[model samples]
Target chain A: MKYFLYGGCSLEAGGKNYMVSLEPVCKALGMEFEEIEDWNCCGASISYAGANELSIMTLNARNIAIAESTGGYDIVAPCSSCYIQLVKTNHELKEDAELRNKINVILKEGNLNFKGSLNVRHLMDVLYNDGGIDKIKSTAVRPLKGLKVAGYVGCQTVRPYGEYDSVERPKVHDLLLKAIGADPVPFPKKMQCCGSGIFLTELDRCLGLVKEILDDAIANGAQLISTVCPMCALNLEMYQDKVNAKFGTNFNMPVVYLTQLMAVAFGMDLKKEAALDYCVIPPEGIIKAAIGG
Target chain B: MAGNYDPSFAKEVFDNVDSGEEIKMCMQCGICAGSCPLRHEMDYPPRQIFTLIRAGRRDEVMNSKAIKLCTSCYRCKVRCPRGIPVIDVMHGLAHYGIKKGIIPRKGTAAFGGEFWKMIYNIGRIDEKTLPLKYNLLEGLVPGIKSTIEMAPMGIQMFLHHRMKLLPERKIKGIKELRKMLDKAKEMGKGGAN
Candidate 1:
């Protein structure tokens, strides 16, 4: 299967490792990625700041128009924020004719038009739905049998427009891990918010939220946390020391992208495919111990 | 902060804020507040904010930190018994607050402004430059102080190659994207600048 890839902004820098790990995982799953040419930011960063609904819709409309002009491929966004922005724009445009007309009017200035004929999917959804559990199991060369992992789906991956899994309690992420032979622990806070960009603004409060999630995962015997969103992975992994300092608790949890764990199971190169070195907290020891690397 | 109620404020919100009319469906259920991760830091939880909007507490609602504290978690929206799209309402309130020149949180406003500006310029964000611009929004002194404060983690990220030192390149269709964005702003009835 082939899909249009929207890397978004984070994937270029903060989430580079996710981009690195995605290639091998997709290759192993028999999926091909075709990037949407000249795609702009999904306008998620400004959604809450000062952007009106029309402004955001117009930005994403241009992208959809670009993809539509190329082919009829579904757009796959690895970043949850991008997924929400694209999905929400597609849904709104399809639902409201007036809104669609307004967005297309804006798009006309760019010599483009939005037809809203594409499906916007999160990367996790593509893996869980398109790449079935059996396919994932078959692709795995080394099954991670005894490793306990907390599947952190974060907020935007499944919420708002959750077609593939439960909004309140998603199991697709966990099930995928189980298929790879990893034990997904009972994490009550799996769907909890990691404060996203709020960690940049409200540091102290964001740390509190991150602390609860890490505490829950660790309490439930999660040796490492597997996450779907780069923002969540950053907040959970990068904020451990901050959470420790504020709450007077030490947390050394290893947060990783879900695809990285899949790479390990597929026996792909740890340095090239998994990009484990990019992690703030080293997960190599636990991962190696589990898979007997 | 009391007795300054203006009945027109709620109407303005209903007509102006995106999905603001959905606030009428709110039934005072505290589910949104209960589900909010930042409730402790908020002056008024979502339900109370909705009540204040209806009560015509314009200044109180506009100045409240509750609206800006939302991180787009979607927990409130998903769990809302009324399906009111609480997250949208909150974000709409935040956007409206900015339009009306009422910034409840300086850091959030600064970060969002810088982010939007970068996207407008190159049609993409440069991670290395975004923080530098955001930090300097408060002037060189505070910017330097904050940058220094974050040096440890910044160094860690740099070492891990999570951030690039080189400047980000503009997209091939940046001019086209800019024209669209400019038209979007020109046609804005109250949209972002």
Candidate 2:
């Protein structure tokens, strides 16, 4: 199967490894990634919050135009915020004629067109649902034997429109871990909001919320966390220091993309896809224990 | 804060915000507020914001940082007994606040301005440029000081290949994209599209 990859802004910056690790892993599973040409930022919350709904929709629709120009429908975005922005725009433009017309007029000025034919997808949706867990098992040369992971899907990917999964409680991510020979820890707060960007505006509240999520993972005996969103991964990985400084806690959880683990399970060499070095807390010892030297 | 309420505020929300008309369905259950992860930081949580709107507290709702600080998490909307689109209303309030010549939160407002400017211009955000411009928005001294303070993280990011020292190049069709965005700005206030 083929998918158009929308890396969003974070992928080029905070999520370079996500883009780095995704390509080889997907190829191993016989999946193709065609990057959307000249794709712009998804106008994440802060950017969109400043603009009116029409302007927001038009900007997202422009991305749809780029993706559609690639002559593909299934466009996969690794960042949940980007996935939501594109998918939500796809849904709205398909349903609202006024929105569709407005976006088309804007596209006309740029000499492009949007037909609302593109299907927006998060990478996990394609990996587990579309590609099927059976394929992941077939591609696995090394199972994640000793790893205990908590799957953090966050709120954006599941809300409003989760085509192939549940919003309140998703099971596919956990199912992916189980298929890969890892222990999928039971986490009640898996779908909870991690305060998203409130970290920028309200530090105290953001810390409290992030601490609650990490505490749940720790209490559940998770060695590390698996994430689908770049922002969620960053909040879990980068904020551990600040969170520790403020609360005097001794939590040292390593956050990683699900694909990184998938790559490990598929027997990809650490040299080819070493995610621990990219993580804020080096999970080298934990990774060694899971996959061995 | 009394007698400062605009009776027309509720109608304005109903008319302007997406699913804002559903504000009347809110029963003060505190579900939205309780579900919010940042409710502690909100001056008027969703339920109270709805009540204040009904009470016509124009200044309160408009000026509250809650609107601007909303993280767009969508927990309240999913759990709302009234099925209110809480995030949309919050965002609408934010845009409305900006339209009313209100500066909700200067730091985030600056971040938003810089982000939009980058996206509108180059079709991509230059991670290095964004923070540099954002910190420097206050002026040279503070900008350099903050930049120095952030040097550690910046170096870390550089090592990780997250922050490229070189500016990101514009996309091939950036001129076309700008034309559309520029036209959008002209229509922003009228919102007629």
Candidate 3:
């Protein structure tokens, strides 16, 4: 399938390893991504405080028009926030003609227009739906062989859309985990908020939220948490020390991107393909034990 | 509370805020508050905020940190029995608050201002610069103190190569982007048309 990538700001900076590991995983799955030229920030969840609906929508509308200008290939946003903004734009524009016309008028300033002809997808959705579980399993050279994983879906991936999976009880991430031969533990807080960008502003409150999610995952006996969203991965991985500091909990759990685990299972290099060293809370020891490298 | 009430506040919200009309559907169900991950942090939960809007508690609603503190988790949106897009309304209130020059939460407002300005100016964000700029919003002394507080993480990220020391280049289409954004703001000047 033709796919154009919209790697949001986090993937370019803080979550660079996510994009690194995703490369090999997609290649192994025969998925090719061409980066969308001159794509702007999705405005993310923070846009709500700073911009009105029309402005944020116009920001994403530019991206949609950019993709349409080129073959209109399906846009795959690795970040959950980017996916939501893009999809929200498409959903809103398709439903509201007056809004679409207004946005189109704004787009004319950029010498572009939004036709809403293509699909805006999260990489997790693209992997689970387009690349079937069995296909992923077949390509795995070395399956994980029942390493306990908490498949954290985070918020925006399944919520509000719920097209491919149940919003309340998402299982696609777990299903994908199972395909790689990892045992997905019954993680009740899998869909819980990780506080996203709020971490930077409200440190204490955000840490409280992160603490609960980590506490739940650890309680369920997860060796490591496999996540899809960049913001989720960054928050869950980087804030563990702070959570432990504030909450006085002795917790040291590894947080891995879903693609990183797939990279290991597919028998790819740990340092090169998986980019395991970049992780804040490294999973190398547990990962090595799982695959017996 | 009576001193701060304005009877037309509800209608103003309904007409101006994004998805603000949907607040009318909220039946005072506390499911939104119960579902909120940061309910403790909020001065008034989503349910109470809606009731405040209807009660014409304009200043209380706008000045409360509840609206600006939303994490956008979509938990309330998914679980609401009334199908209220709670996240949107909360964010809409936040945007409306800022537009009216009432900052409910200083830190959130400061960070969001820098974030949006970065995006608007360059069409993309330089993660390293965003926090630095946000810290400096209060002045150089506070900025230095805040930056010092975050120095450890910054150094760690720099070591890990997660943050670039060099300035980020503007996108090729930044001019066009600015034009579109200028027009969007102009059209939205009359408030939520």
- Native contacts retained, all candidates in order: 0.78, 0.53, 0.73
lDDT of each: 0.87, 0.79, 0.87
lDDT score for residue A50 of model 1: 49
* TM value for model 3: 0.97
Which residue pairs in candidate 3 collide? none
Write down the TM-score of every candidate.
Answer: 0.97, 0.94, 0.97
**Order of quality (TM-score):** 1, 3, 2
Interface RMSD of 2: 2.1
Against the native complex, each candidate's DockQ, computed on alpha carbons, is 0.73, 0.57, 0.73
Error of 3 at B187 (Å): 1.7
Ten contiguous residues with the weakest lDDT in model 2 chain A:
A269-278
Model 3: lDDT equals: 0.87
Chain B TM-score (each prediction, in order): 0.93, 0.87, 0.93
Cα lDDT of candidate 2 equals 0.79
lDDT of 3 by residue, A158-198 (tens): 76777678989888999999999899999999988899877
Give the better candidate number (1 or 2) by DockQ.
1
Tens-digit lDDT string for candidate 2 (A1-293)? 88788888888788777877788888888888887888777788777445676666667888889778777658888888888878888998899887788778877878888887878888888888776889888887788886899988798877666586887788988998888888989898898777676565466677787899999998899999999888898777777777898999987888888888887888886646745567667666776787766
Q: Is candidate 1 or candidate 2 better by lDDT?
A: 1
